[model samples]
Structure formats: structure tokens, C-alpha cells
Target: MSSFLTLSIVQSALELGCIYALVALALFVSFSLLNIADLSTDGCFTLGCAVGAVVTMAGHPFLAFFAAMAAGVASGFITAFLQTKMGVQSILAGIIVNTGLYTINLMVMGFSSNINLFNTNTIFSMAKELSESEVYRSWYKIIIVVCIVLLVCVFLAWFLNTSLGLSIRATGDNEYMVRASSINPGFTITVGLCVASAMTALSGAVLGQYQKSCDINYGTGQVTIALASLIIGESLIKKGSIFKRVIFVVLGSCLYRFIVAIALRMNLPAEALKLVSAVIVAIAISFPYLKEKAGFYKHRRDVMRQASKNV
Candidate 1:
């Protein structure tokens, strides 16, 4: 590729990566910290997109973002209530909320399956208005969003190091132990889910504004994508400090986007995209396991060789 084309691809990858990183961070809170598989992300994301699109169309771009966040929090609350109060499994509760949000998102979008804000005032447009040069205007939106996401990640990492954050981590690691220490596991789960869903909502709002449209199917397979990103990030980074982990996650998201962009440029068949994603995730998730197995085989081979030589 030409240098300009390479630069363009890198730019697009970074922008898209930042967006996906937001979703992955949300999943990290629930999956990595809360020990819950939240399927509600798919619905909540779409709900946020729908709310943002509709509100922006109604001449309330800023409010639209918060509205979407509120919707996401409500969805999280419902799932939490189901799990904590109604005695449903966490995964099941997420499924219930996700299913419900489908209809709710449609309602929020004026009962339509999709809403296009192609010519409406969106967050990107607002950013453009605040900029002078066309190039700066084009870059400003992504830069602002990336900065916000990084701030959130930093805040989360710091929070996780706090007393309350420790409690949340304890709840994930050993709920029984946390309860023995007089901590409420239910509360921890609720709080984690709330934060996670809010992040997901923010991501959805940005995505809607970025694309100038919101579709019901926009969030389909989102959970898988988030999981894949998290797995890839975790695999790439050494588990040391919280700050390092957060940074690694962001880097992983960027790397994942770059890979996808390269695949697209190679003219990979659309039908193979899902398979590619699955393969990537599987390799990431199984890396440690594979390493262990390889070590075992090597040890066995060494022992056999030594025995044969002695014989």
C-alpha cells in the first residue's frame, strides 16, 4: 500500500479500535471483575444508539448521549434485580434484559427498526463546529472520544485499587470469602454491572454519532467482539499493575482493529469475517493452555531421551 493509504488505514483502525476498546472495557468490568457474563450489552448498546439518534434528530445532541446512558443503566438495574432479587442466574438475567431492550430500543426509535441521522446534528458535527480546518475537524471527533475513553480507563484502574474496588475484586475472586468478611457480593455485582452498562451505553452513543445512524442490528454479536478483544488484550499484556492492564487492553483493541483493517484491505470474503473473529478469539483464549501442553510434551520427550541414553 502507498504511504497515504497506510496512514489512512492506521487512522481508521485507531478510531475504530478506540470505540471497540470502550465496549471491551465494559466487558472487562463484568466478565473479568464481576464474574458475570452480561449478554445485555447487545441490547443496551443498541438502545443507546437508538436514544442518541432520536434525540439528536430532535435537536438535542448532548442530551441524547446522557439519555442513552440512562437507558443503559436502567437495563443493568433490571438485570441486577433479576439476579439478586428474583433468583435468576446472572447470564439468564442478562438475556432477559437484552431481550426486553430490543423492544424498548425500537420504541425509543419511534417504533422503527433503525434511525438514520445522516443530516442531523450529531456529536461529530458539534465537534466540527468547534474546529477550524477540515483536517482538524475530521480528526477532532476521534481524538476527543479517545481521550474520554482513556480517562475512563484510568479512573477505573484507580478505582479498582481503592477499598471499594478491592471489595469488588474480592467478590469476583471469592464471593464466599468476601461475604465472610461482611462484604455484600450482591451489591458488588450490582455496582459492577451498573458501571459496565454505562460504559457500553457511552460507546453506543459515540458509535451512533460517528456513523450518523442507528440500527437495531448494530449490536448483534457485540458480546463476542468484546470478549474477543478482552481475551486478545489479556493475552498480550503481562498481569502486573492495574494501570498496565488497562493500557494493554487499549493496545489490544487497537491491534485487533489493525488486523481487521488489514483483512478488509486484502478483500477477504464477507462470509469469512465471523470465522476469522472466532479463530482469533480462540487462539487468544487458548494461548496459555497451548503453552502448558507444549511444555508437558517437551518434558516427556526429554525424559524419554535421557532414559534411552542411560539404557
Candidate 2:
């Protein structure tokens, strides 16, 4: 128990949570706002990692972010084009893009399965050099990740309220209504997906730098994790403005990480973490429905008690 409460453990969980919060935010945009289930998230995430790793290894750490985002935009564009122009279903389009991205990712990694950044300079390392204090150095990773998460939250708030953003939202709510209002649902979807994928790629870019390595399997189950985080956030913040909702998405990611960290501390094998994630996802997905059912049953029971008293 005491080991679980260590500052190092907490910091690690928080840093990872913040990094993954970007993925959650991406899902929030595409899944919740735009009503699109992008199954390419896992592949897109690895694409970001591969691109970022290659760029950083080439002596341009900062450029890796933009490069990764560009790659993500391209991936999203292909998926969108398939759905909008090639008459592919959204799910099928995502699957096709995802499958293709695996080959591309391997090529980006020079046909290798992994890339190590053991001695490479990354954004985290750059931040660490800005301060001389040991405490500052120790917390640099968390500071950078938190700052990025905050910036992304602010961006989501501002962007989602814009005219174009509103169009995307409306397109998700009712494609016919948006089309009747002279807005192109296809265009809105393309823009929304591209933006969301950029965020997801950014998350992967950060994670690659933080861990100082990129693995082919690093992105596996990313969509499930992001979906679980988004659903957990929505369950926690049932009614709020968009900004508040986005903020809670970060919180949810942190909470999920804390749970996993605790499980690890309790002697659970690493292999079991996937099962844990699956369980969390199932619970998060079903929570709202279960809550409504419980409420209905309670209401009926109360009504029966009142009628019995009157009789």
C-alpha cells in the first residue's frame, strides 16, 4: 500500500495520463462530437510514433511533432476520401487505412520493428535542460505533458465553438439537416476527422519521446483505451459545457491510469492489464444504461409504496 503511494509512482501515472489524455480528447471529438467511429486510431497512433521517431533520430526533435501531425492528416484524408469519394463505408474505410498504415509504419521505421531513443534528445530532454534544479528536472516530464494537455483542451473549446465546428457538430447530429442548411456533411466529416487524427498523432509523438522508444505494438488497443477514457469522462461529467467536458476527459485518463498503477502494485502481471482495460471499458460503456435502469426501478418501487400506503 505504501509503495503505491510513492511520489514516483504517482508522477509516472500522471505523466502517462496527461500524454494519453490527448488520445482521449481526439476520441471525444470524433466519437462524441462528430459521431464517427474511427477504427484507424491504433494505426494512426503508431504512424505518429514512427514518424516522430524517424524525425527525431535525424537530429530534428521539434520538427517531429509537425511531421507526425502531417502524417496523421494524410492518414485521415485517405480514410475520409475513401468514405466520401470512393463510396466506402466509414468503418471499412478506417479498416482499410489502418491496415495500410501498418506497412507504412514499418517502412518509416526502416523496416524495423522498433526504434530506440535511449540517448536521443526529445522534447522532454529539452525541457529538462531549461532548469538547473533537481526537482525541476524530476518533474519536467509531467510539466510538459500537462502543458500540452491544457493547450489541447483550450484549442478544443475554441475550435468546437467556431462556425465550422458547429457545422461539424450539426452534421453529426443530423446529416440531412446540415445538408439542407447548405452545409456539406462530407466536408465537415473530413475536417473533423483530420483534426481529431492530428491530436491522436500528437499523443503518440509525445509518448514516443517520453518513453524514449517506439515499438510496433505500442499502438495496439489505442482505440479501446481512448474510447474507454472518453466514456469514463462522459459518465463523470454528464452535463457540462464543451470545455468542462474536455477538461474531464483528461481527468478520466488520469483516473484510469491510477487504477492500472494500483493493480500493478498489487502484484498483477503486466499481461493482466489488458483484461483490466477491457473490464474498465465494458463498465464505462454500460454505466449510463445501468444507472438509468436503477433509477427506473427505484421510481417504480417508490410508486408502489405510495399506492400501498393509500390503500
Candidate 3:
């Protein structure tokens, strides 16, 4: 175990963890804050990768991020419009958008299954070139990802406290109440989903640049990954301020990546990793309920024993 758990392994895990945390943060906004299950995450993520890759290859590595986010915002608006105005169910709306995004993503990739950036400059490469110290140079990727995560966390924490942000939270808690207050629940929902999708796309953009390649299947199972990370974070933190919650979500992503790293070191086959993720997600989601049931049974047993003694 010690042999495989080297510093390089830890650093690699941290980089990936921080990058994926963006998606977890996105889930926090859509699922936790807005009470919406945006199933378009998987497709939106790939769309970001495709868009970022295309833009970066066009000599605009920095601009790729904004382009990808804009595409995601558009996707989110469509989903929101379908649900809020066209009377489609939220889940069904997400499904429709996700289905359409596949073709769109392919088109963005020039109908190709993959785009390689081996000869193209990426954000990570730019960061590497800008690093001054040898130590920092070695960790340029980590520095980039960590800074990005910190910025996102701080932005989300601040946004959630603003008036519009509060309204979005209210819409999540009770749309009827928001409507009663003339808050325009539809508008809040649209804003919430748009922001969430933008974050998700940004995550994909970073990942694409980090890998220096983008595949059509790059975002497969991203929804599961984000959901699992979010559940794990919530399970651990339980109750906290918005800032604390968002911070722990990043930590949870790191921990999840660490677990996956250890699993890989266990000589497990590649196919078994998905199963491990599923198990982890299931356990994380059910932990609170299981703990509650256990406590209830223990209390009942103690009460019965006390009654017997009294009798």
C-alpha cells in the first residue's frame, strides 16, 4: 500500500478531484439549491469539451472557456424553457436536451469521435510555460486547478447569499410560496439552471485542456460522478453554511478520487471501477437513513430492557 501511495499518485488524484469538483458544485446549484435534477449534465459536459477543444485549436485557449460556458448556458435555457414555459416535466426536459446535445457535440467536433490537441496549445501548457520556480513548475497543473476551484467556491458562496440567489433558493424550497410572493419562480429556475450548466461546462473545458484531448464519450457517467460526489459531501458535512457546504463538496471530490486511486492500486480490472463507484454512491446516499434506523432500533431495545427490569 505504501509503495503505491506515493506523492505523485496523491498529486494526480488531487488534480483530477479539483477538476471534477466543478461538476459537483454544479450539482449543488441545480439539485440542492434549485431542486431540479438536470440530467443534461452528461451531454452538456461533452459539449463543453467539444467546444473548448475546437476553440482552443483555433488559437484561443483562454476564450475556449467562455465559449463552452455560453454553449452550456444556451443548453440550460432550452431545458428551462421547456419545463417552465412549454409545460414539459423537468426530468423529461433534461432528457430531451441531453439527446439533442449528442448530435450537437458531434457537430462541434466536426462529426468526429475524438479531437486530439497534441500539437495545439492548451491552458495547462500555458500555465506550465508561465511557471517560474522548479517546484511550482512541477505542480503547475495542480496550481491551476486549485485556483479555479477556489474561485468557483468563493463565487458560489457569495452568489447564494444575494437577493436573486435567495429567490432561487426559495423557489427550490417551495415554488408555490415564491409564486405567492410574486417572485417569478420560472425566472429563478431559469437562472439557477443556467448558472449550474455554465459551471458544468467550465469543468469539461478544464478537463479537456488538461488531457490535451477530447473524446465523444468523455462525459459518459458524469451525472453519476457528480451526484456521488455531492451525496458524499452532504453525508459528511450534514449541516453547514453555504460556504462550508461548497468547500466540503470539493473535499468530497478529492476523497472520492483518492478512493478510486486506491482501488486502482488494488489490481482491480478497469471494468470494476464503475461498480465500485456505484457502490460508493449507494452507500453514501443511504448512510443517513441507515444510521437513523440503527439508532431507533437501539433505543427501542433499551426501552424494552428497561421495562423488563421495572416489571
A best-first ranking of the candidates according to their lDDT comes to 3, 2, 1
Residue range 209-311, candidate 1, lDDT tens digits = 8888899998888888788888888888757788788777878888888777777678788778777777777877898799889999999999999999999
Q: Using alpha carbons, what is the TM-score of model 3?
A: 0.95
TM-score of 2: 0.96
Candidate 3 lDDT, tens digit per residue, 122-185?
9888878885898988798998999999999999999999999999999999867886897988
- Candidate 2 — which pairs collide? none
Ordering by TM-score = 2, 3, 1
lDDT agreement of model 1 with the native: 0.85
lDDT of each: 0.85, 0.90, 0.92
Best by TM-score: 2
The segments of candidate 1 whose C-alpha lies over 4 angstroms from its true place after superposition are 1-5, 132-138, 298-311
For every model shown, the clashing-pair count is 0, 0, 0
